[model samples]
Target: MTERLTYYLLRGLFGLLARLPWVFVHGLCHVFAFLIGRIVGYRRAVIRANLSRSFPEKSLEELRQIERGFYLQFAYNFISTPKLLHQSPERITSEHFIMPDLTPLEEAAKSYDCVLLALGHYGNWELFSTGQLLLSTIGYSMDQVYRPLKNKALDRLFAEQRQRFGARLVAKDKIARHIVEYVRAQDGRHWLVAMITDQAPGIGHATYFTDFLHQPTAVLDGIERLGRKYHLPIFYFDIERRSPIQFVGRYVPLYDPKEGDLPNYTITERYARLMEANIQRDPAAWLWSHKRWKRPLEHYPNAVRSARLQALLDSAKDN
Candidate 1:
């Protein structure tokens, strides 16, 4: 019915846009970014505030530059997503997407039943699904854990797009039993459980406060807990956008759960540090508009780990 029709109409529109010349598509993105970035004034302000708080050392002019660049990147990401929907495997791989050194992950996966892949909002995350498909072609079963869109129609469309390459899409809400079963069932075959680690966990969830840039940020402990409980290998996927059409992936190993007394926080810290490093390298690529610190420390004080963070916030008010 209505939902189905809406989905089809959106898909048709995207398909039409995808057929346009690359320059035209990119130009449309630039225009869209300019318009939306202005229209969403409150969101832009919030992003600026967060950016300023995080990078206190950066000048206002520098912050503004980063803000504008982020909007441009956001616009391009939206435009490219539609093109990705209609793109073939050969087209994606041939277009400067390079994965460097997956040997460690491949070797670790053979022994561990599951692998928890820590990724972030940086780069074109949509391509991560395609990359997983490429890995599957070489014999790995990649299951992507995703938070479903609020709109059911959009959710269905996103699921369809992700599954086009044969990778399994598991909703984050329905992931526990499915992940355990998949790991046990697929022994020799590599299993990748990819989750974006940069998002703030919901209120009451266990989180560690870390110094990201200059701000005290709460990092999710879910990945570490899961890896420890399931004895899964942990790896971080570092994505670098080399050009308008190219990306590079670097894999970093975290810890072995089988070893006596694994440092869970250490592993999570390493991943978070890697994400911060990547964001510093390309400030525009990370999602800047997310209300990452929505839940205040007053409401969830236990989540805050660094006393220095509280001191910084206190000092900011005085200044």
Candidate 2:
């Protein structure tokens, strides 16, 4: 009963907040940033550690600046995310979230039945859902893959907000099945699958270790495998925050098996490099509080690794 009441209270609070003007919400983000980053010091150690390790070449002062900026960006993403639930399609598709020249993606969709999107937890990633409505204008179906949250009520809330714009949410494990069904149905509609590829791979998931952000990082290889098997065209977004309430994005074609064959881990390596460049452009824009390197490379026995990555793993394991 208490948990249910808490969920309702949060739902109501978010609904009220969502109706507020962007300026007011922007102001609230400052307070939220201060409370979490300054007063409560929420995951300050983790954030600082992540920043320092990823940019070892930087001085203490530089890392500190990045750390502070990360907190503000994190706060903005969290507080403004719920606004998607109440905002109209016009409001969601406005200048606040710009997608400049989607010509490349559109042309690719014309040639293929499915396009895979590789996304990182950078910028206001939640706003990417606006693509369901925005891309639909061009006759494309959008689907996002998500791992279910532990809390049932919170998970339900997230589902409602995510699907509010017309995108279907598929369970991580069932995404392949969904894609297979979509393709076999021969509906003659273009489908876009968006996957957040930067997270540390979960247990039982295939992983590949590579030098990313100056460390041996583990990345999910599912995108590469699926794209190769199904000959799907893949793309990644280059997003830049224009203001506290706005972001401008460009879709860049990453890879397509239909073009030609590439070496093993080539697709994942390209994605890692692209994501690394994105984080370096605005260090604070990425999610620093996440324990990205928590799972040491040595944990996965079957993980694919290059010589340098393996050496790093061996050295860490010996220490």
Candidate 3:
């Protein structure tokens, strides 16, 4: 009963917030950022620790600026996400997420059977999920593999927002089978599969590790594995906030199995490098509060398969 009331309250708040102009909402988000970072100090330690470990060269003062900037963008993403559902397609594309150079992705769609997008938790990722609407008009269909949140109401809310632009949201466990069936069913129609791969792999998920942001990171190998099996080319996005309310993104396609000979985990390593570069560029748009390196390498079940990664993680820890 209490949880139900809380859900209703949140839903009502979203409705009210969604009605406000973007500028008004932006101001409110600044306040939200200040409260969370300065007064509330919500996960400040985690954010600091993440920033410090990731960029060991940054001085204390430099890290603080990044932290503040991160908090501001973080609040903007949080506050704006709920309200985004009410925005028109024009507002979404024009003012919110402005992706101008989709030509490369379009070409990939034309050439590939299925294009797998390796994504991360960066700058208005929820908003970018709506890109399917734009791509679909050009004959490309989009689907994403996502692990639902614990709260059912919130999960439903996210699913509705992300699926608004016609992107299919498949459960993580069922994603592989779903993609296989999708590729088989679509025939000539191209399926663009988006998988946010940077988050710490949950139980029974990690299969590869790499040096990401100067720490031993366990990366999900599913995207690369599926790409190799299905002959799909992998792509990643470079998302940067143009302003408090706006973002610009470009797709960085990693490998073309048909064009080149690349080994396994090449897609995975490429994504890690691309994401790290983006983080280095902005240093704040990426989610720093996430415990990205929580799971140690030794805990992984397939140590022999991942021995190289394990050694890297151990070496990072030693120095």
lDDT of 2 at 245: 57
RMSD in angstroms, candidate 1? 2.5
Per-model TM-score, in order, reads 0.91, 0.92, 0.90
Q: Write the per-residue lDDT of candidate 1 for residues 137-178, one digit (tens) a residue.
A: 556778888988987788887787777777789888777787
Model 3, 112-200: lDDT tens digits are 75788887888878887778767877788888888888987778777877897898898888878877886688577878888888888
- The lowest-lDDT stretch of 10 consecutive residues in candidate 1 is 301-310
Clashing pairs in 3: none
After TM-score superposition, what is the CA distance of residue 83 in candidate 2 from its true location, in Å? 3.5
Better of 1 and 3 by lDDT: 3
lDDT score for candidate 2 against the true structure:
0.83
Would you list the C-alpha lDDT of every candidate in the order shown? 0.77, 0.83, 0.81
Local accuracy of candidate 2 as per-residue lDDT tens digits, 114-144: 8889989988887888777778877788999
Q: Whole-model lDDT for model 1 versus the true structure?
A: 0.77
TM-score of candidate 1 to 2 decimals: 0.91
Superposed Cα deviation of residue 311, candidate 3 (Å):
10
> Candidate 2: which stretches are off by over 4 Å?
300-302, 307-319
Sort by TM-score, best first: what order? 2, 1, 3
